[model samples]
Target: MTFALGPRAAKAGYGLVAFDQAGSTNAEALASARRGDTRRSWFVTSEQTAGRGRRQRPWIAPRGNLASSVLEVLSVAPAVAATLGFAAGLAIETALRQVSLEAALRSGGRASFALKWPNDVLADGRKIVGMLLEAEQVAGGLAVVAGIGTNVVAAPPDIPTPAVSLADLGVQVTAEDLFSALSDAWVEYFGIWNEGRGFGDIRKLWLERAAGLGQPVAIRSGHAIIEGIFDTIDEQGCMLVRTAEGRLEPITAGDVHFGSVASQGAV
Candidate 1:
């Protein structure tokens, strides 16, 4: 079956390639960028034999899940490019809402459908979507790949965190359908980002849909564990964890847990 984005992708100067199965879409997106294919493009697949989330942990998806990555070419510094993770997450949220996620929310289920910290979309505190940002230097500028995977038809089993899918919520959607919405939503969000000039807006909107805000959470970073209330994400996209001493520590990277029963992972 051939899946593709209609006119929105072409209007945005995007060229796309898809695979029936791949080890990882992020790897393919980066490779396409390195091969002198300059136009903005996306790599997509429905089945992934090997996928990875934060900390190189396994990210498994069924045949109907959406596995996609976009090759973003920007001239900004690495710090600025990193903020695109927020853009990607926001885009996915917007797309899903447009595709009737809001209607699904009213049906009453365990899934609340909200964005999790750093880069994840949670349904009733279980993760429905996750993203990984990968960056490297290409010839004239920086190349970043925002890899996203959504559990549309099926969620992976036996994971550290609780996972949910659209099907589980009684909302029917396919990987191709979600990707079509995502392609357009990504362009809209990218315009809102304005090459990182509009991060303030992104931060405000992201916090509004953020799950676990003002709630206690735990983060595991390197050899240490930090426990605190879920404070607002700062201007630079770092998570602010307000410790018991009332100090707000910035978390730029870590595996965050603490929101539902499936939380509390090993440090």
Candidate 2:
């Protein structure tokens, strides 16, 4: 069965689609987009069996978690889709803040949530959400699918890092409510994209919510690992890190690890 977005989301012009179960929202979205679907849809699932993360890592989605993929059919180049990932990250951060604040108000507890560079959302320094974006070439341009998985009730057991849930944090949020907030956030974030701003605004917003800035970190790209101080992101969305040898390195793609030097690490 398919689930549609709520009235608030409908007013935002996002077509919300929900599924009881799916292998992967990103996979389903790509398939739908290739078939020329112009729905501008948000595909949310109750659970995902084969969710994927950056660099083909496994994305765990428990029953009560949030699993969603937002697809946008773009007339721009595929490279622009990469910039959209930054926008998506910012959107998720915004949504987290909204729900966390409400949860805090309801429970009278401290609300703590932060964002890791690229696309990881954390609560009290433990990971609570992760995102994966995939793009495909359609007839006219590229179809971008951004998949977001947020732990709401249960945590996975196989990951190296510690995982936390909203329930564990004293914030009880339902998957549907989280999806509503996310859909609204995406509508606002995508407006920046439609303006042809080229990720400048998104970059600024990301830096504001960034977990590590001016800190030493390690970036793993392909077979090479570079250890440096995280400086800033370049215009092309590449990560700028200062190495131990006092050299500046631009990272196009890699896994970032926060160092132990109160500012330096690698993942």
Candidate 3:
């Protein structure tokens, strides 16, 4: 099936450019922005040849997988734009629930979907979706691109954390169907985000679907490591970890590991 925006997204004036294959949706979106295509738009493809996640980690979406990015230009600081990633996470989580009946049936039962902090979506404790947000100052405003990738047919192998595909969960979902749902869900949550003005509500809702909350966690930030409990995120979306010494430490960025992997410091 070909990709088409949901009714809500179309009505909200979101534009789309669907490609049979692309190097990177995020890179395409940013390049468009630099060329003055600043209107809110989506760049999507099923076969992404070259993509990178946070910390420049390689992420490849083979044929039948979903690689999508949305671009928004606003007169906000990069700090405020960072909070928008929360809305992106929420959108993908909502879309996964909307498209997968098997996932819905498994919810609160066996394998379920949850949002991982910084930018990931987890299914059955394995990574299923990954996200990256990049921004650049353009002529009109700060151009922000939120890239989201979902494992529809296959998952990358030999990763630090195990990855799962929708097929693995008995979810017979197409990338086009999931993208349609995602476009609609993005309209809903991005409205709530309101360019960071409604971040309090986003933070609250994100915690509701957040994985690893109140669980033992370890965050590897560069050469150092911070081990603690996954308490909550702050108003600005910074993760707050309650250490063993009773201090609530704020972490801006890290490679996080939860549950037993944290306790064993295996990550």
Candidate 4:
């Protein structure tokens, strides 16, 4: 099926590209960035044969799933650009909430959707979506690719954290349908980002929807594993963990696992 942009995405002049099959949507977006067309291009595919997530973990995309990436060139510093993950993460939560609400009405049980530390979306304690952010220094500024994968119809059964799909929750949605909602939600939340001026609000909303707050969580950074309270995500989007020694430490990058559900993972 030919993929078409929704009204909001089309009006924004986003360069929409879709493929029947691809290795990785993020790889495709990165290639487009190298060609100097990374203004607001979105690359999507139904199935990914070579997709990899943060820490180079393989992301297997079966036929019934959603995988897409958006590329944007920003003049902001790479440090500031790194926080865009929160914007994209919140957008996914918002978009998926709408879909889940519909499913809730049908199933007669409200499906709880939440944001995990760093940038992941969870539905009722199971990972329903994952995101990966990639960046490269370009001529004028930094080009960042926001890659998002949604478990629309199915999830990897053998993964560390349990995975759940929309279908598993009684919601039937197509990749095209989810992508359309995501594109529109992206525009909405990114506007709230307001060139990072509205990060405070974004942080507030993210924390409000966060999971495992005030709860014990474990993080594996490199060779060391640190267990602490899932304190908060600071304004700069760092995870603040209050260690058992009563010291509050901010983590810029690490893999987070909540309670006993955590497996060897990445953020």
List, residue by residue over 1-267, the lDDT tens digit for candidate 4: 456676887888888989898999999988887887757888998898899877888887888798989888887877788888899999888888777676567665446889987777898899888899999977646888899999887898876578898888777767887788888888888888877888888899888999999888878788877777888988889999898899888888777898764433333
94-142, model 3: which lDDT tens digit per residue?
Answer: 9997777644565532247899988999998899999999999999999
* 10 residues in a row with least lDDT, candidate 3: 102-111
List, residue by residue over 1-267, the lDDT tens digit for candidate 1. 466885676688888888999999998988877887766889999998788998888887769899999988889989998889999999888777766554456554324568888999887778888999999899857898999999988988877677878888777767888898899889888888888999999999899999889987888889888888888999899999998899999998877887543146433
What C-alpha lDDT do the candidate models reach, one value each? 0.84, 0.78, 0.93, 0.83
Model 4 pairs in collision:
none
Number of clashes recorded per candidate:
2, 9, 0, 0
In Å, residue 79's CA in model 1 sits off its true spot by: 0.8
Question: What are the models' TM-scores?
Answer: 0.92, 0.92, 0.96, 0.92
Model 4, global lDDT: 0.83
Q: List the candidate numbers ranked by lDDT, top first.
A: 3, 1, 4, 2
lDDT of 2 by residue, 1-267 (tens): 235565656886777667888889999988888888866889888788899888788886868788999988887766767778777887777887888888778885445776777678878877888888787888746788888898888878777457888888788778888787888888888887663464787788778777778877877677777887888887667788888888889888877777573244444
Best by TM-score: 3
TM-score of 4: 0.92
Best by lDDT: 3
